[model samples]
Target: MRAQPTAKSARCTACRIPSRRVHGFYWRSLGDVACFGRPILLLIRIRRFRCTIPECPRRTFAETLPGVARLPARQTDRLRSVHRAIGLALSGNPGARHAATLGVPISRSTLLHRVCSSDADPIPPVRVLSVDDWAWLKGSSYGTILCDLERRRVIDLLPDRSADLWRRG
Candidate 1:
């Protein structure tokens, strides 16, 4: 379906000035979630607002749809979220296969990219740590493994397995 912003005035992205005069409009094609077993594509008519401030660097700015989707994104917010969840649960090829089966029809690489690009919750600081020696080779070399006990995840791996190196870290 086709759509456009109905607001008469939009704020300039650079100067934050509200403008009623529309400089121009452009078309944006976005991928949307499937409906009734069919994929949906939305054609949005985006409006451009002129930045009247002489000091402002931007001459014109496109209206932003914060709730719909972020800039430079081809898919809608909810659709991308669905794809990201699938990617996180299945990962790589398995995720892609599952997405296709669900009628999302996204590639494995795209799914992975979506998952990686999305912001993750910030991890809290490590209060307790667990250190141990991990063998690089079965009997040839070894390394030090540092883990965050609170988070239950590996924090870092030291190249040398020497006691002094681990103590200094």
Candidate 2:
């Protein structure tokens, strides 16, 4: 079955103006979850609207549907969300294995990429800091590793083990 956009008008993203003039229509293929134990594909019909504003730089724009897949996205929104969760929980190789076992086929690299692309908030300001020194070449070069004790994450790695290096880092 084919689906069409519900909205009659779309706002131009570039100029921020509501446009009702239809430029054309196109078919977008999307991947969906299993239906009756079989994978499903959706062919959605989308409308393109011409910008009404005279000074608007954008000539046309496509309609967007809520709960559907984003533009240029192969899988559905729900599937992407599930993949993102698995990626965050298991990460990379483990995540791929888990997804395959759950009947959601995904590569290790894709899982890793999804996790890396997700929003990551910056670590909060840490009051407590720790420093440690380690050998780079055993009996030769050495380096210092700085950590935030409150956050429990590495902050920086300095090339020298000197006290001056610790103070600077």
Candidate 3:
């Protein structure tokens, strides 16, 4: 005979309540397994409950999955990592094409969004910096960029490169 699975009661990570009751079931697709070479799918029966405390802000919440990642996201954490890698390597149209070859469908605009959304730690402060100007619409408009030699990254962008702007920096 097979052992029957038991429904365990657990506290919510966000609300810190143990009064929640079982609510409903949902399906989630997990990342592919390297050793098994197969994708994992979780058929989870999530729990829901009303907040016993009247002062509590939230009234209802679903059971939390610590192993699972951001809620409502289609791809797993590993797949998101892969997408980020592709976005960094190729960038824009070329990156999208490369991702398609790797079985991940991505567009140039999507890649740009991902790149802009990255929240890596802020670069350290710089001592000496360089400013340069580039024409956006040739002979019509120009833009200026400030670069930090030590950080090796663009620190600021301005509408135009001017002596006043340099003094302000």
Candidate 4:
């Protein structure tokens, strides 16, 4: 299906100035919800508005449907949600297999990337420390492991397992 947006003016993202002049329009085909077990496509006629500010470097900007999809995105917002869920539920190969069965054709690498690309909470500084060592090549190279007793996780790994190395760290 095809549809033209009704928004005549849009605010400039760079300078925050409202633009009313219509430079041109472009057709963007987006993947929408499935219809009767088939993927439905939505073609939106997006308008490019000329920036009113003279100092702004951007000459024109395209209108956006905030809740629908992000700029330069091919899939719908809901489809991204589905991808995230599938990506998190199962790792790469298994996720891709399940996604294909569910009618969403996504690559195994893409699923793995999606799951690992999310912003993670920062780990705070550790107070109590636990030091240990393990051989790397077992008779060749050795490494030191520093763990936070409170957090119960490895804080850092040193190249050489020694008292001097542990003291320096």
lDDT by residue (tens digit), candidate 4, 15-85: 87888999999999887656665666789999989998889998898888787877777877776667778
Misplaced by over 4 Å in model 2 are: 119-169
lDDT of each: 0.86, 0.78, 0.63, 0.79
RMSD of each: 5.6, 6.8, 7.8, 7.3
Give the Cα-based TM-score of candidate 2 against the true structure: 0.60
What TM-score would candidate 4 get against the native? 0.61
lDDT for model 4 comes to 0.79
Worst 10 residues of 2 by lDDT: 114-123
Ranking by lDDT: 1, 4, 2, 3
lDDT of 1 at 92: 89
Candidate 2 displacement at residue 168 in angstroms: 18
Structural similarity to truth (TM-score) of each candidate: 0.68, 0.60, 0.49, 0.61
lDDT of 3 by residue, 1-169 (tens): 1111144665655568676465554444444223333334444455565556566687766655554445765545565666677788878999888776766666789767766764422467789898788777889899988889886888878888677876875
Error of 3 at 84 (Å): 0.8
Tens-digit lDDT track of model 2 for 48-112: 89998888888888877666776678878767777788999998888988877776678999778
Ranking by TM-score: 1, 4, 2, 3
What is the Cα-based lDDT of residue 25 in candidate 3? Answer: 42
lDDT, candidate 1, 89-140, per-residue tens: 9998999988877778799898899889845334678999898888889788
Q: Best by lDDT, which number?
A: 1
